[model samples]
Target chain A: MLGSEIPVFMTNRNTITEQYPKIYLYRRIVQAKLFIDANYADNIDLDNISDEAYFSKFHFIRLFKNIYGKTPHQYLIAVRIDRAMQLLKSDKPVSDTCYAVGFESLSSFSGLFKRIVGITPSIYLMQQQKIKAQIKSSPLTFVPGCFAEKNGWLKNRNFRETKS
Target chain B: MLTKMTHISINVLDQDSAFDFYTNKLGFKVVVDVPMGADGRWLTVSPPDQPGFEIILTPVIRSMYSKETSETLRELIVKGSFGVGIFTCKDIFATYEELKAKGVEFTKPPTKEFYGTEAIFKDDSGNWFSLAQLT
Candidate 1:
């Protein structure tokens, strides 16, 4: 017990341990985000998500918003809308894509999708189809301007040469 | 003569989550956890049963790094750009399952390789490591 009483370093403060609770709390919040990412297709709500993070609904909302810049409900909607956009781009029908992304009703899905993405799912799908068709007809137009220019394939094309 | 390496440093975005991940999920034991104040924490953990070698869970903070550097490092960590090291286990399948059950994220399942059976997993902050069972 020679060195035990002195406590080598002054001020018995293990600062890192003091911050462990905050760190573990952050891990739980991140865990909730990962849960949403993995189960966005399921019928997940604030209750399920908050429970997943082991936080109460109100506190979880505040913590999630502070970290992600959006409330839990908003984040879930954004995630659903983001996935819906990807599915719609792949030519999935709007109704199927809506249900697939966990929206119960087509109307609510379209409304939320338009509010977030600035276009209806059907319109977005049509736009994606149009772009795909254009790409198919003239793939060079879709290539990066610098890439085309570097390959000397832009000599006769009317591409408004984007500045590198 | 340097007979063995003592510590390896891992850059983490958040020391708190990194600590939880290393201690709770990975089951590493904390060897040293001292706060360096503005310079962040001097935190190190050793793998279970490996008491000598330590893995320093260094936090990337503004005091220790410039704003641009910290931002870049944070992005890189989240993008899983770094593969820190390899850890060996007695049985890769059992270890993988146990870690998986604890919510550890495995980027690749246990797969057969020419050298050994390996599985890749990422820590909470996005730094990945290879877990292998050498044959």
Candidate 2:
């Protein structure tokens, strides 16, 4: 009973049939964002992200930027910077945190970090340390070593110091 | 004291389109359509049979949310991750067929379940709803 071809109805500009493609485009854009969110820590590039959404890079980039008001690269950087902030908060060394957040080089990581967060990693670490020192009387609680290691945090202080 | 839900919100990708979808396809009645600010409207709609509760068709605009959050909400909506709620009809089969004729896309055709005869349909922005004739 459901196999028959339904006649296409077009009553107005807001018809669901007319809106389907636009809705599909929105879905593709969301898929692209989900892909970036899931793989932000990996070596993800624009081509692969667009591929994940089954759209051409140019089309995906345009739609993503139009819908989200930011380019895919900008979103990726935001995601990476957010991860880097968490790593830095946990006292991970600058260089380790850079690679852990998927930056190819220290210079690029530092440049973007300063551009976005308005400070270099070391300076940010210093600020975090100052905050921690102020709250030291409350007894610092470290996330368990297993969770730390799972998040790519170096558990050994000497290793972190040497890397820094 | 406010003890019951008088209004609920359903975030839509666009307010104008949502107005059409809810009013034209789903046969909801517009409750309010007043201007809110420079670019927003206080748009709300209610089901034909239910007038006391209004569903606010809020848009995911820049003024309402940050760019990241707006984008995230749009993503969630398009991914069909948000289920607005279940709507009850007198006859599930009749309602399902009537909605389908009105261009609503049903993800699941009417089926008999332990609870009732249930069907699923998606709105213009990909939010799904269960239209059921509960037992």
Candidate 3:
């Protein structure tokens, strides 16, 4: 009676579907990535991230690094630093941005920021602010020369002149 | 006589997501988007400026492949085993910045390679591509 309830075509497909397909592995890896993206601000580690995909820690590390070109730890640090950069650009204080982006201490945050970004967070913040002010003062100077020249607008204004 | 190659096939996990990634994210134009019964769609797209060459976004579907084979192929894809192709842009830094701002994940940022200035980024389905500006 239970068998008769299924359509003939559905019954045939169900036999194939019953196999534990390997093709679904990509979905699990992607799910793990999505988990990282959503939880990057939280204090997460290799074990926590790997468990999201149902893979063992070592295997997950290898698989993640192979696909993403970085270990899970490295990728997590990059994500945190990227978020910190954005926060600093928005005028967030250096100390605040450290904790905001999941870094535990200002000293470590500043040190790591310098290592990856080539400048301390405070200096980077100041640089962004300066660039923003410059852009506001002379917007045309920021436009690509090719774009300005193609539109024939360069004939009217010299970007080099505006900079001074 | 065979004149030139016109199409390249790419294995995508999902055709619909690949469509959005190729068109909206990469700015490619669609060449064909037609249903193919249960196997999925015959979807192909080309670079915005280069309209002649097409990249087929072939989906690995249950109807077309044995469950075991699909599993193997999907595992390969997620492992970043495929380097689909190289795309050229006029300004490597500018293009790199633009694509990054649009949520493209770059495994290696723009670095000066012997062939040219190159950067590598992965698509939505975990297939990596070399984005370069040749010298």
Candidate 4:
């Protein structure tokens, strides 16, 4: 009797499992995202990433977007742009930063950066430079020093009073 | 004239996971689970004792949002930027223990506030809700 019921139980379990297949798909999508995060700087592609997650490219794209709310390419671009923002904050040039962030062309990089970040790479660099300059030029209001007379605080106070 | 709300929507990161979180973990009942479009589902759930009201678990997908908007909303949701609303129970402590035992992640355990005894737990998509037993 138990042996006869085994296939029936398996069929019922499979039916229930089919009702919530997205949970398994969601795990595959997460694996794809982990791959993207680790290798965003490399020349990643749909075929390779999908293969890594053991999914077809078409199904992977739909499942990934459904689960993550962003397509794999969009997520990759977001990651690349984020890294580009950090690189651009330093002395890196826009052209070099573009390629360094995994974009093959400068124009496409600039276009995507503008669309997502609301500014072109050059403009972002200019803003970063302006921020850096402002921070550099701001006056220092406090300095650490000993307050004891031997450390010159009293002498400085006296000098200030005499000047005033 | 529109005095009572019968349905509300909560944007979630994933509909399937949200369904599991709401129904299994939070002890809500599935109200509806229908296909919305090719890539989306119209999923809703209700609290155990709340019969009429349903909370739709809407996925933040690109069909209803641009790429940038979807990205921004997903980021915010993952960062716990949206607090969906409040749910009330008769015994806050008991409900909290029950939900916690069911694997619900609570940001704030049950504590006595000025208004009531409240706890905070986030949905699967990172939107938080306050569970309170008011005085």
lDDT of 1 by residue, B34-85 (tens): 4333444557889976999988787776344678988999999999999999
Q: Give fnat, all candidates.
A: 0.00, 0.00, 0.00, 0.00
Candidate 3 residue lDDT tens string, B2-87: 89987787989988999989976786877655443344555678996798998978776534467887788889998999998899
Q: After superposition, which runs of candidate 3 have C-alpha atoms over 4 Å from their true positions? A: A1-22, A149-164, B1-135
Cα deviation of A18, candidate 3, in Å:
16
Candidate 4 structure quality by residue, lDDT tens digits, A37-71: 67898998778888877888888898777655689
User: Alpha carbon lDDT of residue B22, candidate 4?
Assistant: 89
Flag regions of model 4 displaced more than 4 Å. A1-164
Note the residue pairs that clash in candidate 2. Answer: none
Cα lDDT tens digits, model 2, A52-128, are 88888888888887755679999999889977977887789999999998998999999999998899999998887
Displacement of residue A86 (Cα, Å) in model 1 is 0.4
Interface root mean square deviation per prediction: 23.1, 21.0, 23.8, 26.1
Off by over 4 Å in 2: A1-164
lDDT of each: 0.75, 0.73, 0.73, 0.72
Clashes of each: 1, 0, 2, 0
RMSD of 2: 20.0
Pairs of colliding residues, candidate 3 = A22-B71, A23-B71
Tell me the DockQ of each model, to 2 decimals: 0.03, 0.02, 0.03, 0.02
